[model samples]
Target chain A: DTAVSQTPKYLVTQMGNDKSIKCEQNLGHDTMYWYKQDSKKFLKIMFSYNNKELIINETVPNRFSPKSPDKAHLNLHINSLELGDSAVYFCASSQVGKRQYFGPGTRLTVT
Target chain B: TQLLEQSPQFLSIQEGENLTVYCNSSSVFSSLQWYRQEPGEGPVLLVTVVTGGEVKKLKRLTFQFGDARKDSSLHITAAQPGDTGLYLCAGGDSGGGADGLTFGKGTHLIIQP
Candidate 1:
C-alpha cells in the first residue's frame, strides 16, 4: 500500500479559478505538510499540521489555505490561482522525530 | 526561513564514476536527512544524521554530518545508471517547533552508462 497518496495527479485551470488538492496517508502519521517545487527544483515548505493543529505557516500567499480534518488527511485549496502557481505540489507526513514520506505530487498548471 | 543550499546543482557522470554532493546552511540543525527522488515518484529517504560529526554508510553510499551541525555531505562510490535521480538534503530543528523540514534546491545527478 502507498504510504502517502495524493489525488488528481495533474490539474490544469485558468487564472482566477479555485482548486483543491487532496492528500491522505496510511502510515498513521500525526504530522502532515504541503510543499511546492518550482521549475528550478527548489522545494519549499508551505504549511504544516500536527494532529489537526496548525503548526507552521510559511510566507505563502493568503490565497493558499490548508485544511486537515484529521491526522491522516491534509488538503490544499488555492483561490484565484495565478500563473506563478504552476508547479508540482507534494504532500508529506511523518511521525514525530522521524523522516518524512512524500506523495507522488500534483502537477498544477495555471493558464 | 531556514535555508539549505546544495552545491553542484547539476551533475553528469559516466557509470563507475564517483561523486560527492554537499549541503550547507548558516543556521544549525538538530537533524539532517538525505533523499533520492526518481522521475514521477516522491522522494525516498536515504538516511538521517542527528549528531555532529556523525557518519553513516549505506552500501556504497556514505553520508556525513558536519561537526557544526550546519552542513552535510553525500558521497556515492562507483555510481551506476540506477543512481541517476535528484538528490535533496533537508534539515530539521527540533527545538524550533514541530514544523516540516527545510530542503535544498536539489542536485540533479545524471549517470550515463
Candidate 2:
C-alpha cells in the first residue's frame, strides 16, 4: 500500500478559481506537513499539523489554509488562487523526529 | 531565506563520470537529510547524517557531513542515466522533535549515456 497519497495529481484552473487538495497517510504518524515547490524547484514548508492541531504555519499568505480532520489526513484549501500559486504541493508525514515520507504530490497550475 | 545552499543548479554529465554535490549552511543542524526527486514524483529520502565529520555509503553514493554540522556532500561514482534526478538537502533542529526542515533549492542532475 502506498504510505502517502494525494488527490488531483494535476490541476488547471482560472486565476481566481478556488481549489482544494486532499492528502492521506497510512503510516500512522503523528505529524503531517504541506510543502510548496515553486518553478525553481525550491521547496518550502507551508504548514504543519500534529494530532489535528496546527503546529506551524509558515509565512504563506492567508488565502492558503490547511485543515487536519484526523491524524492520518491533512487537506489544503486555497481561496482565489493567483498565478503565483502555480506549483507542486507535497504532503508529508513523520513519526516524531524521524525521517518523513512524502506523497506523490499534486501539481497545481493557475491560468 | 533558504537555510541550505546547494551548488550546481544544474549538471549534465556523461555516464561513468564522477561528480560531487555540495550542501552548505550558515547555522548548525542536528541532522541533515539528502533527498532525490525524479520527474513527476515527490522527493525521496536518500540518506541522513547526524554527526559531524561522519561518512556513510550507499552503494556508489558517498555522503559526508561536515565537522561543524553546517555542511554536507554527496559523491557519486560511475554515474549512470538512472542517477538523473533533483537532489535536495535539508537541515533540521538537533532536538529531533516536532519541527519542519529547511530545504535547499535543489540541484537538477542529468546523466547522459
Q: Please state the error at residue B95 of candidate 2 in Å.
A: 1.6
Q: What is the DockQ of candidate 2?
A: 0.81
Shift of residue B105 alpha carbon in model 1, Å:
0.7
Every model's TM-score on chain B? 0.96, 0.96
Model 1 misplaced regions, further than 4 Å: none
Give lDDT tens digits, candidate 2, residues A1-111.
Answer: 999999999999999888999999999999999999999999998888876667665589999998888889999999999999999999999987889999999999999
lDDT of 1 by residue, B7-81 (tens): 989999999999999999999999999999887778889999999999999999999999999999999999999
Mark the regions of model 2 whose C-alpha exceeds 4 Å error after superposition. Answer: none
Query: How far off is residue B51 in model 2, in Å?
Result: 0.6
lDDT of 2 by residue, B1-96 (tens): 548999988999999999999999999999999999998899999999999999999999999999999999999999999999999999976675
What is the lDDT of every predicted structure here? Answer: 0.92, 0.92
